[model samples]
Target: MLYWTLKYVLLGPLLKLFWPTKVTGLDNIPKTGGAIVASNHLAVVDSFFLPTHVKRRIVFLAKSEYFTEPGIKGKFKKWFFSGTGQYPVDRSGGSAGQAALDTGVRLLREGRLLGVYPEGTRSPDGRLHKGKTGIARMALQARVPVIPVAMVGTDKVNPIGSKMWWPRRIEIHIGAPLDFSRYDGLAGDRFVERSIADEVMYNLMELSGQEYVDIYAARAKELADAEHAGTRVAVPMQEHARDATRTPETEAS
Candidate 1:
């Protein structure tokens, strides 16, 4: 298959030689069955490095734009992403977001490994951001476990706005699977979904050792861009520094 070919024969060896990945706790990943691999988004290379290190094929829900671009380069990107086990989903909110969630749940139910960035977008400042509830909802809907993964040093290899990647040591830490069976049959409850999302984020914060920001990554990016553009926007103080020790169980209680 194309996925195996790329990971083993073509791109994987090249990436390993350059980056020299160090992986730990890889056995935490289930050898079989469906699970959601939730991770913190740092840089674009996080996607490439994580899949190559893992033995199983990880199907990620990529933004639709990657597959919809026009012309020759676009065609190659579409083919590459598709051949490497990525499926395009619209990131726009409302119906499009729901559609993506449905697609993820369907994949999980079909016993496939689904890689998800719970933060929804890459962090603008390398701090872990608050997670979207879509991942929690999908886990609940599919009755699957959620595995927390942390990719360290990927930001250095491919920083934001960089067109080329540099050789850097990469560390991948895979954490134990999280079970949400206690909240079974509560897929549509917004409060439950948020709690689950928070729990996953908490694990990622612990694993990656990155400062946790309670704001969504997309919003943080917008505020950062505005400030960079000389707009006087009141920046909201992040509460995570003070509340960093709080866990989801404590919040739920």
Candidate 2:
């Protein structure tokens, strides 16, 4: 299959040779069955490296734009992403978001490993961001465990807005699977979902030893961009609920 071919004979060997990745707690991943592999989104390459280390194929719900671009480059991207076990899903909110969650649940029910970045987007400042509750909902609905993975140093290798990748040491720390069976029937409850989402982020914070930001990564990016443009945007009151003990830091380039 194309996936194995790429992993074993093509891309995987090249990346391993250049990046020098170190993975720990890999045995925490279930040998077989549906489970959610929740991780912090550091950089785009996080997708590439994680899958190469895991034995089973990981199906990621990539943003639809990756599959819908025009022209020859777009065609190549579509073919490559599809061949590597990624499916396109609309990331727009409302109905599209719900539809993506449904697709993830369906995949889990079919006994496939679902890779998810609960932060919803890559961290704009190398700090862990609040997790979207969709991951919690999918796990509850699919009756699957959630495995937290921490990807360290990927941001350095694939810095945002940089076309070239640098050779950097990468560490992948896989944590024990989290079971939310106690909330088995509470999939649609927002409060319960938030609690579950927070728990996952907390584990990632500990695993990666990165500062935790309670705001969503998308919002942080928006704020950072606005600041860079010398404009002001109102901070959401809810984001102010972040821990007072933690001081905020400027966004990293």
Candidate 3:
């Protein structure tokens, strides 16, 4: 199959050469059936590293543009993306968002591992971002366990806007599966959704040790870009640190 061929036979070996991938608590992943692997998005490589480390084949929802480009490179991109167990979803708002979640739920119902970044996009400065409630909703709707995952040190290797990659140490931590049984039928409630999102973020914070921001990742990226342009804007790091200033209670929370 193209998946195994590209993974173990090709890109997998090359990935091992460039960056050392250290995975912890991989036993937490379920061997079969439907479950959600919720992860923190830091670098683009985060997508490649997390699922590959796991023994089972994990499917992810990627940007829809990848599936439909008008050239040879586009065809290759489509093949590679599909070969690697990724399906594209429209990133535009409204119907697109609903369709993505619907597809995820459908996959889970069929007993498959659905990988998702609750932040909706990658963090610009390697910090944690506010998680969307979609992951929680999918798990609750499908009645499956949600596994919290953390990927660290990848952003430093690939970084944002860099074509060249460097060797770097990477860590993938798979914490225990989070149980939302208590709120089994309450996924529709906003309060329950917020609580679930917080729980997912809590584990990611502990794993990656990145400062958590209660803002969307895409907005943070926009803010960071404005600051880089010398247009007089606030740095996301300092602002994020101010709220998540590392308190003992924060860890306990």
Candidate 4:
């Protein structure tokens, strides 16, 4: 298969030789059966390296743009992404979350390992951000365990806004599988779903040792962009008031 050949033969050897990755807790991943591999989004290379280190195949829900490029080079890009066990999903608008949940549930039901970043987007400042509840909903819908993974030093290898890849050491840490069977049959409850997602993020914070922020990474990026452009984006007073009282558990949603 192309996935195996790329990981073990083509890109894998070159990656190992240059980056020299260190992985721990490989046994935490289930050798058989369905599970969610929830990780913190640090860099674009996080996706490329995580799958290479894990023995089991990991299918990531990537942005649709990756597969929708134009021309012959675009065709090759689509082929490489698809052949590497990655699927495309549109990540725009409100419906995007639901679409991702549906895709993930289908993969889990098929007894496949689904790699997801609960933060929804990469950390703009390298700090772990609040997780969206889609991950919890997927686990509940599929009745699968959640495995928290941490990728350290990936941001250095390929940081945001950087085109060149640095030959820095990377570390992949796999934590113990987290069971959410206690909330079985309660996936529809928003409160319970948020709690499940918060628990997963808490584990990731511990494994990755990154500062945990109880705000969505996308929103943070928006505010950051506005600041950088010297444009004032008004924050509603009520929203600020609510943020003052926001708890970590409730923010995970």
Candidate 5:
């Protein structure tokens, strides 16, 4: 398959040599069968880099926008996504979540790995956000193990505004697979769903060590945007300081 070919032959080896990342608790991943990998989303690299480090292929429900672009770039994006075990989901949960859940269940039923970020988007301040119940729904539907993964320091290597890759030490900490068979028969009730989602978030918090923000991706995005705006506000002050340092009166001359 192109995925493996590109990974083992190109990306994986290159990452090993150049990226030189470290992985911990990788054995927590199930070597066989269908399971869920519940992880914290940091940077865009989280998706590609996670897959490269894993032994088996992991399928993720990526945003539909990634597949809907123009020209050769779009074509390549679509091809790579499809070939690398990713499927498109609308992300708004308007019929899209169900469609993805359906596909996810199918993958699990067939004994494959399903990768999902319960936070739904990259953490705004690199802190874990309140997880949506989609991950819980998937586990309840599939009746499979959910592995907790925490990827640290990746945000710095490929932050939101960075145009190029900068080397940053990375660590992938995979926790043991969580067993949720205790609530096997109760999957539909809202209260039960929230309870399960909370438990999932708790485990993720332990693995990630991020401050838990109780909100969805949209709200987190708003907060992150505000922080970025603050950075812009401080930039002028920093520039002023630099300018003053260069002034003749401030200089030794």
Candidate 6:
């Protein structure tokens, strides 16, 4: 398959030759069956490096725009993504988001490993952000264990808005799987979903040792962009409630 050829024959060897990636916790990955690999998104290459290091093929739902562009380059992009075992999903929220979640659940039900970025978007400042509940919903609905993965130094390799990829030392830490079977069939409950997502984020925070922001990465990026543009955006106080209630040990560094 193209995935194996790319990983073993082509790109993977070149990446390992230059990048010097350190991966821990290979034993944590399930050899068979379905599960979720929940990771912190840092740079665009996060997707590439994460899967390259893992033995099991991971499926990610990439944004549909990547598959819809018109041109020879776009056609190649679609082929490459497909060959890499990634499919496109509409990122538009509401029904679209639900559809994507359903697709993830279906993949899990089919005994496939699913890669999810709980933060929804890459961190603008390299700090872990609050996880979206969609990840929780998918895990609970699929009855699959969630493995928290921390990708270190990927941002330095392919930095935000950077065209060149540097061969930085990338570290991947895989934590033990978190089980939410006790809350099975409760994925529809918003409170339960939020708690599950928070638990996943907490594990990621501990593993990655990154400063944890209680706000979603997308929202944080928006506020940051607004400030840079000289436009003040008011952050709702309710969003900070989770931060206020956290213990001192779990406080953002």
Q: Give the number of the best model, judged by lDDT.
A: 2
lDDT tens string, model 3, 1-253?
8888878988788888778888899899998989988888766677677767888888887668788988999998898887777877765654656777878888899999988888877777778988777777888889899999988887788777776677999888899998888888886776687788888898889987889977877778887778888676654553332111010000000
Summarize candidate 2's per-residue lDDT along 5-30 as a digit string, tens digits: 98999999999999999999999999
**Tens digit of per-residue lDDT, candidate 6, span 85-120:** 686776565455666787888999999998888887
* Candidate 1 vs candidate 2, TM-score winner: 2
Report the candidate with higher lDDT, 2 versus 5: 2
Assess each prediction's global lDDT (C-alpha) against the native: 0.83, 0.85, 0.77, 0.82, 0.73, 0.82
Error of 6 at 67 (Å): 3.0
- Residue by residue across 173-223, what tens digits does model 5's lDDT show? 899888989989777765676777778778888977878866655465775
Report how far residue 113 has shifted in candidate 2, in Å.
Answer: 0.5
Ranking of models by TM-score:
6, 2, 4, 1, 3, 5
Query: Per-residue CA lDDT of candidate 4, range 23-102, in tens?
Result: 99999999999999998888888878888888899998766777898999889888888767787777665466666787
Worst 10 residues of 1 by lDDT: 244-253
- lDDT at residue 2 of model 4 (Cα atoms): 85
State the weakest 10-residue window (summed lDDT) of model 3: 244-253
Model 1, 164-228: lDDT tens digits are 78988989999999999999999888789889999999999999999998888777888898989
Off by over 4 Å in 2: 68-72, 90-94, 239-253
Note the clash tally of each candidate: 0, 0, 0, 0, 0, 0
Query: What is the overall TM-score of model 2 with all chains considered together?
Result: 0.90
Q: How accurate is candidate 1 locally (lDDT)?
A: 0.83
Off by over 4 Å in 5: 64-71, 90-94, 224-253
Candidate 3 overall Cα lDDT vs. reference?
Answer: 0.77
> Measured by TM-score, how close is model 5 to the native structure?
0.82
